[model samples]
Target: MALVRVQNFAVSLDGFGTGEGQSADAHFGHAGDRLHEWMFTTRWWQPGGSGGVDDAFVRQHDVGIGAEIMGAGKFGHPGWHEDPDWRGAWGPNPPFHTPVFVLTHHRREPIEMAGGTTFHFLDASPAEAVDVAREAAGGKDIRVGGGATTIREFLSAGLVDHLHVVVVPILLGRGVRLWDGLEGVERDFQVESTSSPSGVTHVTFTRTTA
Candidate 1:
């Protein structure tokens, strides 16, 4: 069974995933960069290195992700416009080699990257995007690599099967919250595991059967 998972989704102590007034320069909000300091230092994140925690928690959470789905904001672009010449922020060969489904209001043709990576823009709803992403993922899991809003969309729809959250010790008084507008949505989840390294708390939650 292919599961929909959100990995390393950072959040502040005050529950803000990103600060207000988002822009190309101020991604994740003004002080949102502080939330993801842990991931950037991980050995798995290195360009060409493999030396970090050897726990199954880290390995499963960090690597072997087959495909990714994200909102338009995660691409760090201006609106729902796509230019064939517009390469993503990561450049020619991005980190992700599998297909990436980007949720957007406007539609664009599929973009094939240097590696096996392909960016597919879809105008359909979140559920529709998941269907497309599942096929692209083959037998592997589909990951929701979000910028807050995207995660919330999938969670609200009860489509996420697993969530890995890295709760950073920071407080953004007012910003985009990870759980914002998710008050009424109902789903049962269990804390699968927790790990602490370098003062960062990584928590994994698995959706419980109803």
Candidate 2:
């Protein structure tokens, strides 16, 4: 059976996944690369990088993933809908080698990019989109790519089976938060944590039940 997982999701110490004033130029806004610095140090990012605990977790991102679901914010910046030629921030070939469904209310045709990644736009609920992505996954897991809001939705809907979060040591003060309105969310899963040498903490939540 295919599972739904959120992997390598980085957040600040203050719980902000991304900073304020997000634009095409600043995808992560004021938070910048601070949130993802841990992944950059991993060998998975480059051959000469560290191949320690962080690398091990980063490597799991594609272990069983066949399809991805992301929010429009993760697909592009604020005014991306205005540009008809916007392929994505990932140039010609995106990192996602699977079909990607972007959640948005606007209707747009699917974009077939280089590599196996194809961008599919959909206006649907979390459950509905998961249904479509799971079918396309070919029995592999579905990755819930995030920009905070998208992950929160799937988590709130109780559709996520596993979640991996990296808490970077920094405070954004303000931006998009990942844990809002998720009171008592830990009750649904078995949570575990491990601290990295770089001061970042890796947290995993495996669903206790269906």
Candidate 3:
């Protein structure tokens, strides 16, 4: 079976994955691009960007990833379902080049992007969605692309085998957090941290056997 992994997820020092007041204008809200500044500086994002530890981690985002599971927040801004022509935040060619299952209450037909990315909307639980994605993955790993809440749900369900969280230096103060209600989660995984020169910490949680 392919492993379920969350890769290159960015969070604030206060454990917030995204800031409050999310709108089409402000995707990260008050936090802005501060949380993901580390990724922007990576070679994977830009041609002239640094190829350091940050870039190394960014490069692994799509490796062997056959499918993706993301929250509706990550797919678009608030009230995206009301719009009849809302394709997604990403343009014609999305970054994801595989089947991307979007967890949402609203049901809609799949949106096929220019790339291999196809958005499948579902109002299912984390474990249920993972099962669907895993089957669609065809033996390849499933990438849990999240917006905090979705990741937390998968973590709480023990469906995640590997988690890579980037701890940014900034503090969000308020927003959706990643560690909320997830006490003692470290016990199930072998945690490791590596600090980079850019002031961001790369932390990984590999699930441990009992």
Candidate 4:
């Protein structure tokens, strides 16, 4: 069974996942980087370390992810139009060692990186992207590595099976709200687990599929 999971996604206390004015330099935004402070220090993220909390959880979900689905802003530049020179923030061998389906209107050829990671641009809708990702993932899980809007899209469509939100202790006066337009959408999620470390709390939500 292939699960559509959103893992290690960070959000502010106010539900803002990213700050406004996103750019190459201001990736998330002015104070948006604070959201991911938890993942940065995690053992799986550490360069040469071998100890940290959620090691088992991170290893099971993060490593060897068969395929990923991301929005254009997450994989490449934000806003309209794609840059040919834009490779990715993750240099050379990215963490993902599988196919990555990027949601974009404009068509671009598939990009193969040093590792097994390859970025395939999709002009299709979210549902179409999911189908492609499922095939790419084979027996493994298909992950939705997102930037708020993308996650909301899948959530609204009732396509996400599990969501892992890492709520960081911070406030970005005004930014991209993760649950901005998610009101009135009826969905049930049970708290699978929770942990507080490094001033951030990790919360996992498993969608109740009736």
Candidate 5:
């Protein structure tokens, strides 16, 4: 069966996904690339990168994923909708080689980019968007690429089947957090974790509920 998943999402010790002050120049905001430094060192990111547990887990991010659902914030910086020429931060060929649904109130026409990625703007709830992405996935898994808010919504609605998070040992005093309003969320999942020598922890939440 096809599943809804969140993969390779990096968060700070304080649970912030991306720090404050997001912009075109700062995709990760003030926290910068610190949150994802662990991922960057993985062989999944580069040929000479680490081939340990981090690389193994990061490599699974693309496995069986045929379509993706991401928040507007993940798609672009604040006020990106205002720019007519803005094609996203990934340039011509986005890393996601599948249909991408971007959640936002201000919906725009679908954009077809290089590779198999196509950006489709949607003004829908997490469940509704999942339904749409599930169809596009053709029985393959649906990936929820997030900037915090989007992942929280799907988790709150009990729509996520699998969640893989990389926890970096840092504190972002202020930023968009992934754990707000999600108290006691571990009750629904089979949680597992492994620490890497690179000072990062890979956490996976497999939904146990039917």
Candidate 6:
């Protein structure tokens, strides 16, 4: 079976995965690009970018990933369902080069983009969505590209096999936290953390009990 993974997910030290006041204008809400600053500095994001530890970790986000399942928040801003023309945040050629299943209440027709990326909307639970993505993955790994709530739901459902969380030093006192209801979730996985020079900690949870 293909493994289910969450890669390059960044959160603040206070555990907020994203800040409040999310809108079409602000994707990460009040947090802005703070959570992803380390990623943006990596060579994986652009030419001549840092080729150090941060780059190494960011590079793995798409490795062996055949399909991606993302929440509506990650797909678009809030109330994006109302905008029929909203394809996604990513431009014409999305980075995802495989079938991308978007979890949303307002299901829409599959939109094939310039690249191999095709958006398929589904109103399904984490397990159901994973099952659908796994089939489309063709035996490759499936990536759970997320918003805080989406990752939490998958974590609560025990559907994730590997989790890569980048803990940024900043603290967002009140926002969408990643570890809200996930108490003692470390027990299921052999947790490991590697601190980068950029002051961000890369923590990985590889399922040990699975």
lDDT of each: 0.76, 0.94, 0.93, 0.78, 0.93, 0.93
**For residues 141-190, could you state the per-residue lDDT of candidate 6 as single tens digits?**
99999988999999999999999999999988878989988888889999
lDDT tens string, model 3, 39-157? 88888889999999999998889999999999999988899899989988888999999999999999899989997999999899998998999889999999999999999999998
Tens digit per residue, CA lDDT, model 2, 149-169: 999999999999999999999
Q: State TM-scores per candidate.
A: 0.85, 0.98, 0.97, 0.89, 0.98, 0.97
Pick out the ten consecutive residues of candidate 3 with the lowest summed lDDT: 35-44
Q: lDDT by residue for model 5 over 1-210, one digit each (tens)?
A: 899999999999999999999999999999998998888887878889889998898888889999999999999999999997888899999999999999999888999999999999999989999999999999999999997999999999999999999999999998999989988888999999999999999899999988
Ranking by TM-score: 2, 5, 3, 6, 4, 1
Q: Whose TM-score is higher: candidate 2's or candidate 5's? A: 2
User: What's the CA error at residue 67 for candidate 2, in Å?
Assistant: 0.5
What is candidate 5's local distance difference test score?
0.93
In the range 1-210, model 4's lDDT, one tens digit per residue, is 788898888888888878888888887877656886666665777876435554445565565468999888787547535567777778899878889888888768898998889988898777888888998898788899888889999988878888887787888878777887777544577765565657767777687764
lDDT of 6: 0.93
160 Cα displacement, candidate 1 (Å): 0.6
Q: Once superposed on the true structure, which residue ranges of model 2 sit more than 4 Å away at CA?
A: none
Q: Which candidate is the best by TM-score?
A: 2
Candidate 5 stretches with Cα past 4 Å from truth are none
Name the lDDT value of residue 36 in candidate 1: 67
Runs of candidate 4 with Cα error greater than 4 angstroms are: 47-57, 60-64, 79-82, 184-186
Comparing 2 and 3 on TM-score, the stronger one: 2
Model 1 Cα lDDT, one tens digit per residue, 164-200: 8777778888877788787744447877545465566
